[model samples]
Target chain A: MQMEATIAQSVSEKVKTSGAEAVIRSLLAEKVDLLFGYPGGAIMPVYDALFHYQQALKHVLTRHEQGAIHAAQGYARATGKVGVVMATSGPGATNLITGIADAMIDSTPLVCITGQVGSHLLGTDAFQETDIISISMPCTKWNFQVTKAEEIPAALAKAFYIAQSGRPGPVLIDITKDAQFGEVEFEYSPCQNVRSYKPEPPINPEAIEQAAELINSAKRPFVLFGQGVILGQAEEEFKSFIEKTGIPAASTLLGLSALPTDHPLNVGMLGMHGNYGPNKLTNECDVLIAIGMRFDDRVTGDLSRYAVQAKVIHLDIDPSEINKNVKVQVPVLGNCKETLKHLTQAVKRKSHQAWLEQFRAYDQIEHEQVIEPELKPLGPELTMGEVIRQVNELARGEAILVTDVGQHQMVACRYTHFKQTKSNITSGGLGTMGFCLPAALGAKLGTPDREVVAVIGDGGFQMTLQELGTIFQTKAAVKIIILNNSFLGMVRQWQQLFFDKRYSSTEMVNPDFVKIAEGYGIKGRSIKQRSQLKEAVAEMLDHKESYLLEVHVGKEDNVFPMVPTGASVSDVRLS
Target chain B: MCKDFTITVFTEDHIGLLNRITSVFTRRHLNIESLNTSESQIPGIHRFTIVLNTTEEIVQKIVLQLEKQVEVIKAVYHLDEETVFQEITLFKVSVEQAAQHNLVERLIRDKNARILSVEQDFMIIEKTGHKAENDDLLEFLRPFGLIDYVKSGRVSLIKPDEELKNLHELVNEAKQANNNQSFN
Candidate 1:
């Protein structure tokens, strides 16, 4: 019995494993439960290894490489975990470029693994070879190419650490096929530190004190927050800071849902199609405190005229974002969760009742001129705003709303109500057109208990309609609403106003979307009349499985509260 | 507003870091006039010297973006007045022409250039100076049948005390802290 035990122990200690198996083992060690990927020639070995480990790690086969990466992004945004994706070399890796760029600009955390050609075949233009390392360098926070099996574990660990750390972004690791086939003694150790990469900068107490003094003395202090709050898991800290200061808060498009929609201090969204109060009051505020949000061009219409009167206090984890667009009086550099706590303790509480009333007055004007007419239109033609209103009423501010880019996306961001953080997901920075369908599928998988709804446009829905097959196969209960306008609505709106009503290539004759859904073995409904809207959305929400609901709305409807291309934010029009 | 600026980056030696550093400039459509890379006094650390002509505002932004790279320890930019820098240029001339003209030898002596090599067919001259000085020497040598001309990128040192030594100590401390935490 002793000799038998000795033999078994020695055998277990020196067992050899392939790099493909090592990749799976490393993922399991990282506690990665799900992956979005598609099988291909170069990546076949990893897929083969994945088959035996199916019970521990679940793989969702997406229809395309772009779909896989977007789905991974959705998963990351929904769960605040690093999303994982895999694809083959050459065309497969090239297809993921758009999503990588989208993730980079939006600060989504993802680790994408691509299979490369054999090390010997590199630079020889072998069948499926491409230099993905160079192609992905600008977009990725960091990336590495592994030509040996021994390098797999360390590369993956670093990829995950870099991807999900401070100011999170996407990272890529390209593993050669020969490495996947080679053998090694597989052991896993998670990366805890990279000497040159400091994920979090040291908090400066003096900067926080300066910011608080500005907040305490201001007559009208306005707070602008973004996805950084959600990404940092600092929603509670942000709420405490705003509540303590009694400051009015506005959200950028990506920052929506970081603060509850119905919070008393919450004003509305800010951008080209943002609310009347936030855009106009931006110029009126005496002190502007921007937290965990970069000043994107869409939010600041013309940098020269944006908030020139205000003393800006910017809080961000990234130092580069401080003076990139607008100069700030006090720069607080650290995680918002930590910096907000310090600021909350340092500030003095005082209500700006008169300043608050200014925003309320602007809100009243916007409501009468824009909101009331769009949500409860007197005309026979239905508007995109009303569809979102009905969905909001049914979902009760609890569902996860994923939107594609277009007029419908703007309408959804403007109208959707959220009671929770991380509940509103969209392609904010990159404004990717086909992001909604696959992203919703990944979000649903990430949080299976939540009601997931994908709000898409007629134009954007056709961009990745094949994802319906993924929903059909997985039986994920995602509610899809297509506000079909039979035109590329946002562009058509711009063409109408800016291009002398020349429709150009904006008009689209779409396919039978509901029929396509049915062909995928999922139930769906189509509606054109205003009367059927409420009941149809309710049915979609109550369905036990995946359902598609297409609502045909006004073809030339424009997203309003306009800040035309070069106009100042204060000059936003409500017509 | 556009003037010469020198950017120095200290980083760990890692594969593909150079590409990551250069792409930051390419993304902004900024032209890099010269670039030099070498090992620093500190072991295992590398230094990159890049010279560009841009506004102070844009150069500051580029420096911040460079430090954002994972392997980069620190990135700092200095105006020409704040730094002492030089470029080395090598000129190859036909030996026949050099011996035929006393002006070539007189010009080399006047310009503080030294003869690096004297072969039967070709003569090589080396000069270390600023860009304008090198250009002047090239102009003087062109009439003497200059066969080939090559100039190295600008290599620079900040006029102030060495800040990187202090930064290197801090980096080591942080790495030590990381190691201690991992043990727990």
Candidate 2:
């Protein structure tokens, strides 16, 4: 790590008087190591001043603003720091939207800056002009349009800070061309008064005590962990609490990587694609303790029917998220780790043999019943469900897996064993179609130390298939497994159930994925035989650059044991 | 089919842009409506409009989605005849229509529509005004009527009063508060 102690000063001395320069300098002051960007007319001033911090900032030039954003997401995920991306006005600003929305949905930390046509041309529809601030309103955690040049430094500084704090998500800074071009004497001072956002920091004593008391009181309590645990780095305390109380625990997609997959107390995922023990227990248990996880609809099918048998104790850093969805019997509004620590001292573990026996028996029966293979044909004859199990077995708890939207995603959620938060990245609320590939890039960027695998369906892979070039350019150590069923698999599956297999436009036939992967300068392979999967995965993971392994599975395959839309957990059908 | 026939209002410094125009279109409840409002250039010019969907539901939904932005001030699919209206449209007619086109060319000549271009198929015409102008013009040019036309919806300005001024101030105040909250 080459230290840039003087680079910050060099930037401050040179660009301090200029608005765009001040913005660039503030970013450097915040110790931003990388930025992804595409430059144009309105944003030229920012790019020009960006020259000074070249030593400190590693700027990745992406072909499109969307690519810039996704790459930034990759950078953020890899470094566990806030990602940064910049773009010029109009289309450039709009292009960054999908990526920003993705981060919002998955709760990733990102800072996006877009240039607006000068303040004078604000709503004129001037060539290349867009109302960037208003357009990005709902998609971002916060957004601004800096009309005055003097606002740039503070705006950039605040954008960076807000993006990194409190249930982190994307923030946007839209500076007019005038702002970027204006000159201003800049004095760098730490931003101290953010009046609008007062995040209740992770430090509530009494709530922690009550949470601990509830945890110790219930022998069958289970922790439904999510991404906040990973964001807060609360896994250690999470592990400690589980060990102390001997409580069974499961995780949401975002919370997958927070704990070790091999940990004995680890139950599994609980949701539409949830596994036997976790899913069953979620609806069966008396004490359901959810930590650092929002009760997303995907995770809790038919909210009215979810955890009906359970008394909920919800712990999260975000107060908005606490009672937004699932009502909490015990609300611990603090960081998971801090809250858990307080509980360890405030409460004692209990020995309830009857409750433990009840959970164990249910787990045993369901595991046996659910894991039995239901067959379909395409060589290896592996259903989407089978792939999740195999991936789980082979991973044996070390790989960081990501998935695209559809049945395969759900099956992976149900069958794959996840142990940590922020480990799994998928479009949860957004349910974005072409999320896996780019997001896998983000995930690999987030955790370069871990083996990153993205499980995508044939349809999802095709949506943003243009990103193969990005993966190759970065040489990201990502192994993408394409579950080629030749259909918009999930939609097709739904039609199969709801519309009498009308199929409509759901069916699709894809080109050779391996060939397509190879076309982009990455290693590629296709596996149709069951025996080929394990070795192919091993070889693909070993590749220096990104690799694509396409597995041709059955098109008729649908994620089974499904509780259709508006259906309760008891309405689950296994066919 | 829930297609919307919109009326865009661009008015002079009026005391009641909304009251007069809206009451006209809405009073009869002639049709369900959708409306939108925003400030346009030529300072103090406010854009007020209505969307009446008697056509495709999807387009209506798409327009409704577009109306969701906060800066849009007001956007809804609740339209009726009692709504006030003003609109500008640019249409293209065939050069062939010049020789013997009926009441259409006559109207085109009256509105002083500039013929943008004329090809083997037809010609391009540009016009601006009230809905009757467009309708009477459309009836006249019905023979060699259109290639394509884009109309800006109604835009109405409120009389500069305590209320509208306060709204502008409130908007700035909200923006300031949001900006302050975000930086922290």
Candidate 3:
């Protein structure tokens, strides 16, 4: 448990500081303004140190550790900075697992610090002594444990560097109790490189030329992108690339906000429940240029039939992602901003008017069969789409929308409009429920000037409803909209469509959400009639503070344009 | 095809390094048949040898994944024919029976094993070979009042040298950097 004294030896004057103080000082040096965490016995020293540095940092005490991490994720997603989360050992550390996994799959940068028992008591089944490092190893970009005081600054620096660099993900550092209490001479330095680790791999120029040649020569070129654009902050570059080429582009679920929803070349989302044109035309496209997206199973249904006719050009930052799922004719590896800038310089301006019209034709058909009826509901019951449609109009498609996972998540992603980059945050790869409530808190905290809206379903909202206390304390000014369908609507849709109408346990008997919002001292309202929908949404947006609006929607409504399980992306259902 | 393969990983020695390495296997649900670890020829680095029965496709993916770990320097897998591998086994037999029979001496000589020590209660026999050969010796020594047995995980060496002169250079440069006051 001895720490290396080599790094701090050169300092002319070294202040003796405890491990806890070193951690605080390191965070300050990293310019971490806000941290979200919960306190416990093992982590008390750090919290005690946090008390001394209250003026320099802002710490949000979430109701649960999961809330803390998801809030951090929201903050990270909204802003490009790495988010920080802290918790104690055992249950406190374990509670952050879901959010950690969510951040890992979605490539959000987060640094999680968990307390451990004394160094000597790590493996003796001591109270609150769980092996957080081992538990988080698979999900983290890198993880380490510090049992000695002198190692605290070095490990924190490494953790921050690893978490924020390249294809960012979560990194955890578990510090034992002795390290927090022990004092050592401290000198802080940021880690710029690790011998075996290279954050950004070098891009191949020849492959970029190959990709540019493919884009220029093809008549029916299509672009599919994901969060890598936002992660790289290359939204402008992506927009210019597609606009200059005059090619049709579609986004994965997490890539929604990277391009303006109303952009002429930006054709909607690309997934199972995505827009009609994107899903149906994936196999028909000639040259498929995938940027920053891994072609996840949800986006590429029945991989054997997905984009088989197309010559694939894949651009990504991670090397392992390059032929991991779909084979690529040309692979360009590096940060998307740098590579896209290079590709843009090489690509010539061209238009595929005929190919673009085909997408419009498909969109027209989908509009006639699906979007029209949902937006203008003739039935007595309210629908989820109408709620999204109203919200879309009132917000002018500019509000940052944080969505929980389920049928409602699909509905929001489908109908919501984005006018700016980094405006959409949700659990895309992990499909984690209860993500929006706390994430919306983080998002609003990160971008206080921007309006933040959290769209949740009754089933998903109930999972993390305890975060209402956080909202009440922080007054994050997030607009919470709930689409209340009395069932776990997505699973129920599957049961109805595929399982012969056997509902099973998908149905949920719930309490009044508006009443619950009132208990948290937040403004609230619920609408069951169509006449109240527009005004209620407008009022929710007009309110200066946080507000919750619940709308009762059709119980049996299902998300359409779905490529059935094990089916090709082209075989989308309209009902 | 699904068969035995040994994956070797080189990494910097650090606390929880073993747990980090094993967690990769645990995540993929790949069962480790045998594993061995020790310091390599290079200073400040450690080597781990892990044996798993999986398909060639899976093993390739696993190596790419293991290389992604921050501390891991390199990860490569080799088939049985590609490398020379061995596992050591020890057998302890009753001392009284050992004195009465010539079969024990004959079996030990045939297997190329040798007696480590002879004590009052039991005698110990040691053998080093592949798993199959070691198992054969254990079976041969079982009938003569076998007291206890233990076997170590496999150790392996490929045919060609795994020389990375640059890696040694980096180590030396790190030492040089430590002595001076240069920061990047």
Number of the predicted model whose DockQ against the real structure is largest: 1
Q: What residue pairs are clashing in model 1?
A: none
Model 3 over residues A223-276: C-alpha lDDT tens digits?
Answer: 999999999999999988998899999999999989999999988999989999
**lDDT at position B72, candidate 1:** 88
Candidate 3: count of backbone clashes, pairs at least 3 residues apart or interchain: 0
lDDT of 3 by residue, B55-144 (tens): 987887788778778777778888898888999999998988777777566856688887898888998888999999999988877778
Among all windows of 10 consecutive residues in model 1 chain A, the one with the lowest summed lDDT is A3-12
Fnat for each predicted structure, in order: 0.53, 0.07, 0.33
TM-score of chain B taken alone, every candidate:
0.90, 0.48, 0.87
Candidate 1 lDDT (Cα, whole model)?
0.90
Sorted by lDDT (best first), the order is: 1, 3, 2
Tens digit of per-residue lDDT, candidate 2, span A1-575: 23465555634553446778777777777777678888999899988988866777767666668777876775676467988899999999999999888888777789898888988987788999877666676677767678787777777777776687767789898888898888876756545434334444557677777777667667567778887778887778888877778777777776776777667676666666565556555777778888888888767778898887777888877765655667778888776767778877776765445655665675666555555554223344767766666666676656777788897788776666665545566677678777778767766755678888889999988877887877778777788888888888889888888999898998886788888888888888998777786777777766777888888777787676566677665455555
The CAPRI classification for model 2 reads as incorrect
**What DockQ class does candidate 1 belong to?**
medium
What's the TM-score of chain A alone for every prediction?
0.97, 0.91, 0.97
| Fraction of real interface contacts that model 1 preserves | 0.53
Candidate with best lDDT: 1
Instruction: Select the stronger candidate by DockQ from 2 and 3.
Output: 3
Residue A99's lDDT in candidate 3:
94
Local distance difference test, candidate 2: 0.69
The TM-score obtained by model 1 is 0.97
| lDDT of model 1, residue A88 | 97
Q: Rank candidates, DockQ, best first.
A: 1, 3, 2
